[model samples]
Target: MSSDLFDRIAAIGVIPVIAIENAAQAVSLADALLEGGLPLAEITFRTTAAAEVMATLRDKRPELLVGAGTILDSASLDAAKASGALFGLAPGYDAEIVAEAGRIGLPFAPGIMTPSELGAALKQGARLCKFFPAGTAGGPAALAGISTPFAHLGCRFIPTGGVTEANLPDWLAVKDVLAVGGTWIATTSDIANGRWAEIAAKTRAAVARVREARGG
Candidate 1:
């Protein structure tokens, strides 16, 4: 994969981590996000409908930058790849999954909670890591602290979990955070209520917040 892909992901600021209960809602959710000017979506493997949703989005809206999230094993990784995900993300690092992603030429961001895990990830050749359970893992402050030590290693982070609109600016302000991830903007309840417009509005608001934080 081109390094530019990482730049593209970072430019979006916040990646909408989505879990689809109904396969039919995939395209609509993707459309709402794209319309709001954010092109990236991390369709998580939290539900069985994830693969179907990935296939549907790939077939219907190929322009959206879609990836699989919450992948735990190689089987889930392969299923994501087969469904057309361009990348894969896990809540925690797994050597087998990371190796498979590399073999398939798919960019993967494995999770790291501590400096030790981060060090091990770098040893394994991962420059980009996910700070999962961001709130429980110390949020942006913890990330800020870790960044100082790991800065020389050229490590970057994508903060996920417990990320909210109110706290997004704090997370984005941290220089090491390349992007943030959250599911609040595209929850199943929003889709169930057919609130696409509302979701779009939330997406736009979130993007604006990121831009403001980035001084864009």
Candidate 2:
């Protein structure tokens, strides 16, 4: 089931990292993403409305591939699963949390910044991971560099943090990158001001970049 979700994400080649301040925007946000040719969203646990937004989307826009982000512990993990998030992610790796995810069967991708962190995650059999704060961490060049040692390990990544459309292709160009976490697709201000069209436009532009990078 996790492999299917990951395959869908790779086919789209982008995951809109959304932080919703209000749950009421879920339907409109889903519509905007769909309008722009995107069907994936990572509802981050950065605000109080995260769970509600996920639940609303789960009930209203069932077609969208919704996942949970910033999942720091077992409690948040349980809440995310209950809210119908098909997958989960975090800013960093935690062994206990990863174990808990496996125990519950939630498709999870823990974050890894350093080789050691990546090693730790790989040690526990996690290949799909997040290269957090990608911009500060050297973007594609750095990811490509760190991933060299683990090339034979079947490591894949979802490069998040500071991932703008400008660098979206660069991130996608790396072989290890499955898809990018695009926070710019629909930012807080965009949703807050109900700029659905702008959100759709950004989503479309991101989709275009992914297609262009993949030579589609």
Winner by TM-score: 2
Each model's lDDT comes to 0.88, 0.92
**Which stretches of model 2 miss by more than 4 angstroms?**
none
Q: What is the lDDT of residue 172 in candidate 2?
A: 89
Which residue pairs does candidate 1 place in steric collision?
none
TM-score of 2: 0.98
lDDT (tens digit, per residue) of candidate 1 on 7-43 = 8988888999988788988888989998888888999
Q: If scored against the real structure, what TM-score would every candidate get?
A: 0.96, 0.98
Q: Where in model 1 is the C-alpha error above 4 Å?
A: none
* Candidate 1: count of backbone clashes, pairs at least 3 residues apart or interchain: 0
How much lDDT does candidate 1 score? 0.88
On the 0 to 100 scale, the lDDT of residue 85 in model 1 is 95
